[model samples]
Target: MRAQSSATGRTAKAVTPPHAPSSARPAGRGAGTGAGTALALSGVFCFSLTFPSTVWGLESFGPWSLVALRGVLAAAVAGAFLLMWRVPLPDRRHWAGLAVVGGGVVIGFPLLTTLALGTSSTAHAAVVVGLLPLTTALFAALRTGRRPSRPFWAAAVAGAAVVAAFTWQQSGGALSVGDLYLFGALLVCAAGYTEGGRLASRMPGWQVVGWALVLCLPVTVAGSAVALALEPVHWSAHGAVGLAWVAAGSTFLGLYVWYRGMAGIGVARASQLQLAQPLMTLAWSYGLLGEELTWAAPLAAAGVLICIAVTQRACD
Candidate 1:
């Protein structure tokens, strides 16, 4: 659900140097920050809509079926963009990396998240996903051999504690197993983001994302076919609309903007903006799904935002 670059073609920020650390200040740092922040906030809003849409669509569709349709639709849209742009096909060396990232981001995250939301509330899913920045930071540190500042670690720990406390309170002493699955999905998403950021530094961000989707098209199509074969099809107007929104807004445009931002801002700091997602999602749940806004919502939102700010400031 990231910001779609306007059709009028804004200038892209130059990719960061490979030798630069993931947390290094970006070129055109101010502009990059503004653009990335805007895109990330937009993504949060767009992504917030996805859970409700998933819930709506799932009323008539199986979770895997919904996931499969999302992949196929998103891949088709992205493939069209590639063709329109005349983007060259990725080289053989990139195929494996693209497959892994596509599988994680396009297939794994959506499926697990939809499944998790089947049992958990959208608010619960949002709160769990707020931890993505922390997960991404941890992975970046491990991958780059760059130790995070003490403040970063402290913020991450504090954020996790807040999330745990909030989840426990919300669940009435029993932790929802679905929350665990969301956490796993976030971890996989973090890995994909980290690797994709590295790749974006070397290639055009659009190219990286575009080629990955192209490589993923066959797998996504086959998966969709299998799901269709297994499940009874009962497509409704509401379901069709939801699927289109998820495909266009969440998957295609979202990844495009996210990758573009990652190319300029690098993974760690860029990932911090993801903390806003849960807050945005909470707002969406209240407005769109008529979910009640409880005390925990504000507390969790503030805690995560503070953690993200602290960590990002420390990195800067």
Candidate 2:
């Protein structure tokens, strides 16, 4: 990611006259920073409710049906938006990346987590998913083919350590099979997020996700139909709403800003900010599910926040 962009920026500079004012320089720099910060936080906020939504949705739908239905519903919304805005379809060169994005984000993560949640408590799942930032950073490094510096690595590891320690404490120092599923989800989701971020650098963030959702339609639609045919769904109003939230908010719109932030900032830095997600998830659980708020919750948030701050500087 860094290599291609740096090369392109250099190539453009080489073509310009020495005395040119370079009007493009100042625009993306300052604005990009602010946009990245806002977008990253916004995306995390949208994602924080996924656990609750899944819990509610599973009351009516099986894990496979939930994922399939969510994908189809999200695809419809994304398709309408892309057509309304007249966003161009991705060219052949981008098809592979788009496929990767669809597979990981649209299919893999949701299916894996939903299945995991079937066997685990939401609280346990939330704590486990706090590892996402580290997974994302790892994938970002791989995608960019740029190794993080020693300080950057330290910050990243520290952030992950904080999450692991908190989760182990919360879950009684043991990890379940569900936790393994969530870990797998993190790996695939990281690849999706990193790839989508790279795509966002070249086009609008919404367009990238929109196109991905559309591309997912054939599989999503077919799978949903087959599942519904095989296993009857006992849908409820509350469950429908929960499914809608996951489909519209988590699958589609959340990605809009997530990729934007990753493009504006580097993927590593933006991913570090995801350290705050489990806390936000905890808050949602407390308010919505009547879950008890642990006294250490705030302390955990503070420690993770500090780690994220250190990571920001270290990465910079």
Candidate 3:
């Protein structure tokens, strides 16, 4: 969706109509499409642990403080990468896109999810994130102008419905504010994913994220410092470790590949693979958070996978 242009003075605008036909795309993306998909899946797997890790971190760190710390840590890593690689500064056109990516992923989604998971169960948060792929695809469609087939929408909606129903049942047939937080997380995360995907098509995946993080570094550093000072933390080793892992994996490396995959395969197809994330979260809950996996978890996983597979097979 993104191609480098000689003109670089304006806020980034879609170069082509977002609803253009797939046949309109150029062919250079083919060489790395498969690799990108693999990388995206790997990113997803790494991200699956984020919820459980957040739950752990919340045991010692305040939600805002934890968020700030994670962002700062992640910014450090991203800054190092950009410096080591001597990544060229983004031009004005690309700067707008990078800002969108930074706002969505680097700042918005992390802050929201951290706050949400402070009160919500890791397992529940994971299941809720299952909504992400559909939302991500939606943003991709809007931005790139390629549409999913009707059947794709159907399966996607059904899968979301299944998750919603299960969540309602689990919560005693009532929804709560946490669901709202998760939904908010979904929106911002999808926006980030969409913008990053667009940018990834024109640059190296790692550099895209590194630059975004570097772009946000100033705010992230100040925010974390203020949060830590304003609210005292319990400061456990477990929380520190959890925070570090999320900073390194979820905040940086995972996004590096995720954007690449979305750029390579088209967001709709690439995103369907995120159906596995909730199940992976469930596993992490059991193993790391010591939550018992219920029979319903496996059933839900199977159902979501089937729906995603159906969605993936649809012809646009």
* TM, every model: 0.85, 0.86, 0.88
Model 3 lDDT per residue over 1-316, tens place: 4433346544443343355323123322664666656777888888998888888788788888888788888889978766654445565578888888888888888888888776677887888788888898899899889888889989888888878777787778877778778889899888888888877777666767878888888898888888888877887888888898889988887887677666777677878889889988888898888887667766776678788678767833
Q: How far is candidate 3 from the true structure (C-alpha RMSD, Å)?
A: 6.4
- Model 2 agreement with the true structure over 1-316: per-residue lDDT tens digits: 1112222333221222344322212212444577788888899999989888988888788888899999999999988866654444555567788888999999999999999988876666776677788898898888888776778788778767876887678768787778778889998899898888888777567767888898899999999988878766778976897899999999887987787777778788888888888778888877777777676565666667677777888776
Rank the candidate models, highest TM-score first. 3, 2, 1
Which lDDT tens digits does candidate 1 get at residues 33-118? 67766655565666767787887778667888888888888878777766654444554566677776787788778888988988
Candidate 3: residue 163 lDDT (0-100):
84
Error of 3 at 73 (Å): 1.0
lDDT of 1 at 176: 77
The numbered model that scores best in TM-score is 3
> How far off is residue 233 in model 1, in Å?
3.4
Q: RMSDs, each prediction? A: 7.5, 6.9, 6.4
Q: Candidate 2 vs candidate 3: which has greater lDDT? A: 2
Which prediction has more favorable lDDT, 1 or 2?
2
- Pitting candidate 1 against candidate 3, the one with the higher TM-score is 3
Give the C-alpha lDDT of model 1. Answer: 0.74
Q: Which prediction has more favorable lDDT, 1 or 3? A: 3
**Poorest stretch of ten by lDDT in candidate 1:** 1-10
